[model samples]
Target: MRMLHHGQASAQVDLAWFFRVAPAKRGAPVLVVCGSLLVSHTAKPPARKETKLTAGHRVAPRKVAGDLLVSGKAYANPAEYGHSRAVRVAVELGKWRKELAVFGDRVWLPGLTGSSPSEPLPFTTIPITYDRAFGGERFAWNPEGMGTGPGERGVRLPNIEYVERRITSPSSMPGPAGFGPIDPQWRPRADMRGSYDAKWLAQNWPGMPDDMDPGYWNEAPRDQQFLDGFRGDEAITIRNMHAVHKNFEMRLPGLTCRAFVKKTDGQLIELSMMLDTVAVDMEAEHTELVWRGATAAATPKLRDMEFLFTMLEPAGALTPPTGCYAIFEALRRKTYPTPEEYADDTKQAAKVRAAKAAEQQAATDKVVAEALTYRDTQMAQARARLSSYKHPSVPANAETGRHFSGIAGTIGPGIPEFGADIQAEMAQNWKMFAELFPSDDENCTWTRERVMKTHADGGDMSGANLSGLDLSALDLTGAKLAGANLSGVNFTDTWLQKAALSKANLSDTICKNTLFSSAVMEHAIFKKAVLTGAHFNRTQISGADFSELDLTGLNFEQCAGAQVNFSSAMLKHANFRNCVLPNADFYKAKVAGILFDDAVLNKASFNDAIGPGASFIRASAENLRARGADFRNAKFTEITALRCNVSQSQFDGADFSRAILTRANFSECKLKRSNFDRASLESADLSEAVLLEATATNVKFLRASFEWADLTGTDMSGSNLHEAGFFRTALKETKFVGCILTGTTLAL
Candidate 1:
């Protein structure tokens, strides 16, 4: 037999003496002879004789050649044969043959004999071949057939066929032989005998209860039960073990097996044998036996000796097989579907996406078609309207006698006779026609030459239909075009000085770099108009709707407007100097770097406006509502802002020097490092205001409340603080030198 060492080296070991010890009863003389015995031929052999020897009897020792012999009365106990109920012996002896003679002579016992002189005590002559002892060479030791009498059934191993059938069968193995509990009726497909079918197992296997199930194993939370249960240390251990199993391959170096014995009273004893380690678990006791060759005599005894099921070690690594426990778990969680089902699902999803795309395309096509129809209809109506404004023929003047050609040099040939009276009448007729059909369609076919000629002939073009006409670089001075439908007209670089455009619809007009100096454009609609770099100097635009516009860097110098809507407009760096814009709405306007110098902005709504670095110097902003505004670093020098509510605003580093801010609400304001020198803040509420390091020197603060105000490092020297409230105010390092502080409330 070949014995394998720790280094995987092989050594030849003769195993002939393994079955030499004969089975004997208790207190009986048993001989344990090892190795072959040689007798000398020179001397005659001693004859066998019967002798009565009592217990503990001893015989004198004798020697023949190199052989020594000793006889004594000895007893043998079968219970002391091995420590465990089963002994696992790993051997690789040569192929066994039938009828192999182990011993030639029978063992003679002189103590017990019958009266039969011809009969001798027989030695065990049983054949030890693989076919007779273990049924086949593939068979290993079976604890079920151990401790039986000397016969064919004693050495028969059953695990060879049992493992083969269990691994190759379509159905799951029986409960006692399987690793864990499984549904009895569940079976794998015929084609999945050698491979694992995860989908099939998921649908068939019974999972844990809803409270214990961990749900689908993915990287997100799906079910509440999974979120609650799949946490803490137990989940961490499982994840770690799973990762190790996936990353590393483990294998047992030596023989391994598992066996379980059932007692008569239904108690089971499970045993696992791996190399020299044996782990046995009984119903009440668990023990681990380590087999050291020299110390094998000290093992503890076990109760049961009969095994119900036995397992042989597989031929590969110790990693889980195809249908292992890990596979079972993944199947129960339904982590993935079968290949065929997945393909079908993908195809259906593609169809759904294609259908949705088709619907969206159809809707877009319908909208485009409707827009084209509307444009065509508007164009037709505009053509009909323009036809009604045909120019009237002029009568010949007798004084000039040349077909009324008083201004023939300017009027080209092949045109009708031109005269001041006829031109005046044509202008009046066109104006009346515009007032009759005043539609801001923007598709009016008014050529640039026609508009210029009408303006040149007469300045009375009131209620004219000049929509969408490009009058760029034209000087339309002193023109009367009030109530005109001038929507979408391009007036780029045009000088409309002294033009009357009141109630005119200039929606979506492009007025880039245009000049409207001294124009009367009251109550006009400038919605969505592009007025980039346009100048409205000295113009009158009362009640105009200019909301939500981008008027960046535009000029409104010396303009006069009342109730003008500039809400939500982007007015960055815009100039409104010397303008009068009372009750104007600048709500939520972004007026950064805007200039409102010398403007009359009484009762204007600048609420929620963000205008950092703005200059309002010498502006009259009485009763202004600029609450919650961001005017940081703004210049308000010499401005008169009486009764203004600028609360909850950020005005840090602003210059309000010599300004009049009487009865203003500056509550919850961030005015850090602001310059309020020589400013009049009488009866103002500075509650919850943060004015750190602000300079209010020589200022008037009469009856102003500084309650809950933080004035750290402020300079209020030479200021009139008469009857001003300083309750709960933070005045750390505040200077009040040379100040009139009479009747002031300083209950800090």
Candidate 2:
């Protein structure tokens, strides 16, 4: 009585009513119901068989499996009894569970699934908490069994035990009747449970191919319309529900669909996706894809519903539902971030920009310093050259004429504003030269007293017309008469020392016994002027024109007269000792007895000048042109005439002892009794020249030419005649002892 009768049924139920309804057959309802029942239990129904259930009520096979998994009951199936529901639910669960067990204890491989070898373990563990599964039930916590011992690396793990315990519902309520017994030892084992290892999942899940369409999910027309019309404030968030198992998320906020997949080892692996405005969740293996502008009201359909959703593999395996492939594609190109790591990256970029800015500033500062130094150095050099001018003393035997009687310590007018007065005076002077000033008679009524008054009042009187003026015996020392018209003027015994007469017109002027020492007479015109016994010592007469002038006995010693013109001038007995006359023109001038000792006449033109007994002792005359000049008995002792042209000159009894006359031309010249002892005459030309009784001891005649030349009674001892040419020349009584005649071309 206590145990046998299971008990009278508490409620009488219609078994067929709980089952799926079947469509009525054409003949009767009995056969239709029988056929529907058979179709439900069988694996395949006949292809031509008519089912009582219409398409609307029918469920797909995989969909039934999913529903069973979610609800733990196959309500959509034809099975009505409790035993059938339980058996169907258990079977579907076991099937899925068995597929996921392959990755239970497997480790992940690197590069194959975007998992790096440096990443920690894929499986994680947590303490089995009662709140998660057992609702405040006391339980033993074996920390060593839960991976808390020395065998485990400290990492956050998924609550695997709690999930399994909750999902399995292993124990039923304990009652008097032993319907189901509670067993603590009957726990889920690794062989029977599903595994969701994060690394394993990430390694097995499929990703977008390199050639797939990137805009499949994001750029469709319907998706664009939905996105464009959306205006929501609540941020849309997504999460990978089974990312630890399949490397995939089930629900993505902005995308239409997502999926999870089982690996060969039965582990769920996560896969990548692409979507617009997607932000990655970098906290763990399983995380959500967050975005903006998504609505939760209606289910989002795929942008392109016509194309079947599929996950494609390299081997062409198609996993269905590929609508949200853009999201995974975009994620593949992205780098995940946590808030703290992002902040660190931003700080690092700021530091790098600051460093570059500092470097550029340092470079700019260096350039500015260098520029300032260069400017300061150049200013110092200019100041030195400007202050080199020395003021001359007034001589006693001179005129007492006064015009600001003290010597000027500096050059030029002091007040720059007074330059206008000088310009106006020049204008009047020019008008006077054009026969327009002072009633067109070319007359200047300015007096020395008036000029002195003007000078005292700081008025400039430069470039004034003082021509034909009787300025003799006047003490005009250190006066600023620069650019003045002093043509035909008389300056006998004038104390005009240290005067600035630069660019002045002194043509036909009488300057006998005048003291012009330490003066700046640059570019002064002395054409046809008489300068007999005039003193020009230590003067700056550069670019002066002394052409056709009577400059006899004119002493220009120690003067700087570069680029001066002495062409066609009468310079007999002129002493230019220690003069610097670079680029000076002495063409066709009568310069007999002119002394140029220690002078620098570089690049000077002395072409066709008549100068007998001209002394160039210890002088530098590089690149000088003295063509057709008559320089008989010229003293060239220790002179340097490099590349000089003294062709067609009379050099009888002239001495070139210890001279450096390399590349000099003595062509068609008379060189009788000339001494060339210790001279360097490399590449010299002596063609059609006379060299009777000449001494050439220790001379270097390398590449020298003596074609058609007379060399009677010449002593050529200790000479180097390498590459010398002597075609058809007279060499009577000529000595060639100790001479190096290599490559010499002499007439046989």
Candidate 3:
């Protein structure tokens, strides 16, 4: 049957086999199916019949439907409108009824979405179906009144919508009365999900005709002949339907094809499509051989494959063609070779499976043996005390531990205790383990070549000793190095982010500029290691040791390092912003220009540290210590340093505004030029402190001590000194305006 766009004219339909019909001369026309449309092309034929589909034959009786008329005009007959051709077209309509036209001499087949043809005048007019509903007027066959009105002149075609930031409705097709502004910016509703798959088309193409009936095409029955191998739900996705170059792709059992239409001519002119299949040749080992019962025969060998080849074709105007059937039939006549030919029996298959399992187990055992050998060699070298053997840089005094508190922290208390001689031997083994791995090589592991080869062969070395390796600039991000011995390893500029280093030994390891962001390093040792410019953002460093390290310019943002040790360390310009470092140890640390902003440092220690230019803004340091330390020019704004022991410290040029230092000790501190405005120093001890040129305005000094303190040129105005003792104090030139001096002793 012939298809109709607006029930106007008719063209010949031919179901010619692509490989047999297209002319071999120069460049012949061919139809190729690409995704959704049928595209046409003109390409030169091969010199020889290279395709196995050369034996394919054309379908019989290619004439689908005949005899039709449109708008009372007669279409071209087969004798004049070239030769008849067959076209298989599948249309995708979401929801719409098929538009029907008049039927007379030659019946018009139901179209994808639009109108059918009328009467006996050599039928014409092909239909193009889209997967959507574009509301407009339908093309009617007006045989009685031709060229009467504008509607009778021609049929209108729909246009695609442009999804832009803003959309303005056309003034011609104005919205209903009482509607909002006509040029209002278009916005997709939440329920609509997006504009592409909206039920109603809101924006129409300007200057484009809308002739499609939104409610039609849904009731139309599809012809099975045109949809032979189609999955019955063939439609381009909403995202790709409006693309500039549209293609419909599909794969059948033994064939593949693409359907598309040419748009260079600016019109939906023709359906172009292509199809492809394969061919093979085979023979049995014996002509009279029983193919099914030869498995028990002695020395039975599988049949050999003779030849295998591919066959490509251009299925021009072939709607549900018969050439595909012939190709598959030829393939069926031959037997394809497979791996089953070798095994043939269930027992053989089981043997193959067991062999593979055994091979895998053997490989795993080999790797384990190699790793043991490497570890033993390292231990033996350390015991020999050979001059040629190199050792890792561990803490000088292992008993005191370089960073953490005691000996147990250095070599891990988890290590079993031994006698004196055995302990010495173990210590040497751990210290010298770093010599086995190379620093500059990519394979920086114990027994470098062996470990490297093992890893390449997909072997596991989770607990491998990689100590003292020069692992600079190594890309080990997200590597599973948990529980690995990484002591004295040089990780300068290495990518260790998101690596599993939990409980890993990183003692005395140099980590300059190393990236450990988001690493799982809980309880990992970093004692006495220099960690300058290291990135530990969002790392899990809780229970880890960082004591006695020079950690300049280190970034620890969002790290959860509770109870972590930073004792006696040099932390110049280090950042601990938004960290959860409660009970962290910073005793005797050199914290110049260090930042602790928005950090949770509750119960942490900073006793006897020198922290110049250090910031504790918005930090929670309740019950923390800073005794005998120098905090010159430090920022403690909005900090909670309550009940802290900051005795004998120098707070010169410090800013403690909006800080809570209740019950804190600042005894004998030099507080020159310090700003304590709006600070709460209730029940605090400031005995014998030098407050020269200090700005303590609005300070709450209730029950505070100022005995023998120097307050010369200090600003204590608008302060509440209730129950405060200032006996034997040097208060010359000190401002006491608006001071509450109830129960205050000012004897000096």
Candidate 4:
């Protein structure tokens, strides 16, 4: 009432002329728009609902856990990010996650997701920080979490997380939204959003079975992707102008019409598409689906209009590369700026050189310090083991705890490039590694003399901690390198004959055609390391560790080791068939057909070991003490053992003909297809053992004990028996074909 009618009408009079135009109905004029509309609408994306006309791909779903462990879990579609999230997630979810009963099956859970309680049990606050919704830095990136640490208990975890659940879908089919953009439910908040599929959305929002539910939001996978962008405590949000529906077109980079789409219907839709943004199936390392949702409101025209870009998730922040080597490379390029104080003409080149020298010295000192600290830690552990020396007949020599040297194979011609005239890049890398682990440089150096001498002659240094170093083609024949850190080093064409490298850290190292024959390398760590074409033949390396190392095409024929550790090491094409490896450990080692026939592996262990850890057996170990091992297809001929111990071993397809077992113990072992013809068993203990297809002829039996043993398909032909007792031994299909009977006794 206070305002005049004419003035009130002026306020309402036209600014509405700028209104956005809509498609004309019955050839009518479009509506006018006004206000804060940033961008104009684009064209409506075409729909290609080829769900019924698509094909399927055979894929396995894998559960990831531990360090780089992939569960062979296939998927209907493949996704990949090189070795970034895929590898990391694969390792964590499969091996370290949980037991079969813990998960509902098939929903590939990440490390940060709620874990099942089976093997790697899941908890509420697992201390992990994935999925971007971290409660903060509660969980650190620890490969050996809890008991998996180096100093922790030796509890070997099963790497493959066998996910039992299958991909399940809802009973009813989900229909598309009529003519509008995706509802708020389909495109929910970043932290509280479900998948693009309506079925998954239903799981998040219960009320909207058919209609769009505003409550729909992210669960685990989406939340993780969202957080990967924002990072830390920064708040981020993605806005879209229109609702999501089938009527809009999405435009994504790095994709084309030939690109196949993985639909929720478990098929690969061959129909071409145009999408804005896409959901990345990180595991398969591919863009699985093409999103479509952004219609063009045509005001009776369809020319060059505006584009309404729809962001899929919160904006992400780039994380810096944390790899030490990457940082070192950057610094090597002089990318690290110098100090501001050194900007004067008086302090020009000369001062720069001085500063560089100082920095180099500091780096060297730091590396030395770190090595010393590691040494101190090792000494502490050795001290703990030293207490056993008090026991008589067990001095527990420090050298015994470590393998120092072995009979190296003959040195071949010196490598061509090993001589001083190598590439500058190679030289710098070598120097860098030597600096990181200066202990390897006990007397080695890359100074004027060393470098110049290398140029004149051949460069060689084995049994050294060239970790984080670049040492390509260094002549290290007959070098002594026990317990060295060689991680991330290069040893292309390195000569390491008979080099003692026991208990050494060789993780992520490259050693192509490196000579390791007759080298004593007990208890060596080779995790993610490559030793292709390495020679370990006839090497006496007792108590060595070869875990997680690639030994593909390596020749270990006739290699000998006592109490060796080959857990998680790849032995593909390795010729260890007839090697002497008594008292060895093959816990989870990978092996292939190469050899192991008629060698010695007595008292060996293969406990908790599996394939990729497999091997062709062909060997025998006499007078050894091995517990828990697999020797499938091993051979034994004329093997005599006195006071031998073979417990908890697998000897499938082993032939033990003409062997002696005097005071020997074969307890808790598996022997299948073993031929023990003409073998002597005097005071032998076959307690709690499993033997199959063994031929025993002319065997001496003097106080032999077969207690609690399983003997299936044994042929005892022409065997001399005296004081042989079969107590608590199960004999199935046993044959004494033409065997002598003296003082052989059996008890039920």
Best by lDDT: 1
lDDT of 4 by residue, 48-122 (tens): 222211111001010011011111121111222122111111211111232221111122222455422233333
RMSD to the true structure for each prediction, in A, is: 36.9, 41.3, 33.8, 35.0
lDDT of 1: 0.57
TM-score of 1: 0.41
By TM-score, who's the top model here?
Answer: 1
The models' CA-based lDDT, in order, is 0.57, 0.55, 0.54, 0.43
Model 3: runs farther than 4 Å from truth? 1-461, 528-530, 746-748
lDDT of 1 by residue, 1-748 (tens): 1111111111211111111112121111122211111111113332222233110011101111110011111111234222212111111112211111111122222334422112222321222212222122221222222212344443222221122232222122211121111111122211112222443222211211222211111111011012121101110100001111211111112323333333435443343321222111111111111111110101011112221323233324332333333433243224344687678768888999999999999999999999999999999999999998966445433444674566676766644555766998999999999888857754456688877877899856678888888888999887788999999999999888888999999999999988888999999889999999888889898998889999999888999989999999999999899999999999999999999999999999999999999999999999999999999999999999999999989999999999999999998899999999999999999977999999999999999988668999999999999988775578899999998888764421
- The list of candidate 1 runs beyond 4 A from truth reads 1-445
**What are the models' TM-scores?**
0.41, 0.40, 0.39, 0.34
Worst 10 residues of 4 by lDDT: 57-66
Ranking, TM-score, top scorer first: 1, 2, 3, 4
Backbone clashes in each candidate structure, one number apiece?
Answer: 0, 30, 46, 110
Tens digits of per-residue lDDT for model 3, 1-748: 1111111111211112221112111112222112211111112211222222222211111112110110111122234343312211122223311122211122223456644433233223222212111122231211121111245222221121112211122112211110011111111111212232212122221111144221111111121122222222222111111112122222212222322121323222222222211111111000000000000111001012122112233333332434433443344333332455434545677899999999999999999999999999999988788767776555555744655655556676543554666989888997788677655664643754554455456565567798877777777777678888988988899888898898899988888889999999988888767687889999998888888888887888899978888898888889889998888999999999999999999889889998999999999989888888888999999899888888778889999998999998888788999999999999998877898999999999999988658999999999999989775567899999998889764311
